[model samples]
Target: MTRKILLLSVSAGAGHVRAAEAIRASAALSGEALEVRHLDVMDYVPAGFRKLYADTYLKLVAKLPALWGYLYQSSHEAKPDSTTEKIRRSVERLSTRPLRKEIAAFAPDAIVCTHFLPAEMLDRMLRQGDLACPVWVQVTDFDLHRMWVHEHMRGYFAANEEVAFRMRAAGIPATNIHVTGIPIMPVFGEMLERQICAAEYGLDPARTTVLLMGGGAGMGSLDTVAQSLLQIGGDFQLIVLAGRNVAALEALQTLAAQHPGRLVALGFTDKVERLMSCADLVITKPGGLSTSECLAKGLPMILNAPIPGQEERNADYLLEQGVALKACDAVTLEYRVRLLLENPAKLADMRNKARALGRPDAGKQVLKTVLGQ
Candidate 1:
């Protein structure tokens, strides 16, 4: 029988949406008789609410990280039925009526949520008997937060065993939790020739290459990091990806012109896999999707300025696993990069550790488990 699957996510951050897209891509590549739909819950909300919902998070994380971190911790500790929780849930329910209608119309055999927003709503629907299909939640970070948990969820997907262990400690049955790793797009699983990828980007394959990224919104001291890297005396080149930040891109382009072959500045592009293929190391934020992509490519990372909360937790896991080093500032980032550059054995060991942790086929594993095929 053909199966119907609905993958849900919110645009609060790029990881959740990217995780859903990864599963969709995996389904397409599987050549199964399955129907799949990926929905962003934010799309159904009112324009004002949608803007506020997404923008507030970005603003809080960027401008008031300490406050954001405190809120994150407090919310996790708060009881699910606390007055604040109820008020928040009430507001979400009122804004997401259209989403329920859409889900009813689709009538999926299985529902997967990459973000907690829709998962929480659907959990309510399930308890109220409005939704009959099983709803599975995929935690899109190395750490599991309370928001991703629900009493009636059929199962949970985790990025690592530690998250799975946390799920178990949270009273979720071990059988109901699966450590599938965070899903990444199928392209990262493919093998690409480093020389070819380097040539495609007008880079020299023989030179040590470093890639720097600041998530999808370009939210870090990228210019300072790039300049600091340039000051290091080494036979190496740098590639900086300034995603969706025009001002940053312009600044990087200006910097690139000053150094010619030593630097490559790029704006948003879909060819990140190619760049990863050509690089020896990556200096990036520890977003789940980006880190999973780096792991898939066996690219060791110097994790930089991770936003407090989930990202900080992610850096903790990566560092414990020996695949990454955390750099709290530009000076630390430069020092870490220089240390690795001078220590080829350490870089190689990190790369090997990354490869061991990389679950490039996580998307396939997710689909197979969800569909019971």
Candidate 2:
């Protein structure tokens, strides 16, 4: 236990990295005095291998999602097929050469893996007597896929109660699943005083402020939402996060030019927590990280077009649980925003409900489980 905790993640999707960092931050805040390192497992693989990974796997998931879900489901219903499993094992062996070296150098008490690529590889090595470390796989999404569960893994950190149940349904033992929620930014747990936060955002003290993000990639319906909000002609102001979507950012800038004070558009930045504190209602897709942030801060959402697969599932889950409101389409989305913004009573009620679902101590909860505290 004297050695530091090693956190494993990949950069393909920013969620994995964010999840790993959350645990690292949790450990630091818990007074563990632990050194934390977040490493990408794919970095150990060959360049061609990584490219194939991007081309074959990540792209498919992001684009043709239904097929990706089918493949994911196949992993769940896997029969006794050792040929593919052997290939899987062989590729894992190939990657773990660098991973093994790093783990030895770091000498961690436990390995917290946010992505499956490393957990499967590292766990295989440990089980086959090539490595010795307790590997913990943190399922970064709401659903449980087989890649996330390995025989040698010591435990798991899941995002919600439903995921924990799904893990159990998938034959993973109930004891191994820990519902820590999704560890978002370190700023999530920071309790910003609302009035002060509003002042900092230059938001009106009396009128509501809406924060919108389309994930880190910043691809969402912000322009339409902004235009419709103006149509409603409410006294409220808008704060839009166009994360890394430069075109969208530019477009919003042009829109803001027409009514400068009413709209503010920003490129990818790390100030979402401040915006969360300022906003009365937040319009966003149901990305796990964004959703976790909104929940932790007790911000209600006007959930819109969450694609299909994981996002769709997440949106439905939140809406069903009364944590958010789902707008059927763009029309409903704009109307929901105006309706929620105008009625302070309804907005306050929804906000309080969302806050009730917040586990502000999610990081602390996961840290205790990982550190065996």
The most accurate candidate by TM-score is 1
TM-score of 2: 0.90
Consecutive 10-residue window with the lowest summed lDDT within model 1: 219-228
Index of the highest-lDDT prediction: 1
What is residue 147's positional error in candidate 2, in angstroms?
A: 2.4
Q: Quantify all predictions' global Cα lDDT against the true fold.
A: 0.93, 0.77
What value does the lDDT take at residue 275 in candidate 1? Answer: 98
Number of clashes in every candidate structure? 0, 0
Worst 10 residues of 2 by lDDT: 53-62
Q: Work out the TM-score per prediction.
A: 0.99, 0.90
lDDT of 1 at 249: 90
lDDT of 2 by residue, 1-373 (tens): 4557788887765788888887777777776667888888777777777777644665765477678767666765675356887786687677558777888888887788888888877776787787676888888666676677777778888888888998887777888888888777667878888788778766775666788776777665677777776777667788888888788898889998998678878888877788788887888878777788888898888787765566777887788877788876778887787677667788888788888877667767877887787
Which parts of model 1 are misplaced by more than 4 Å? none
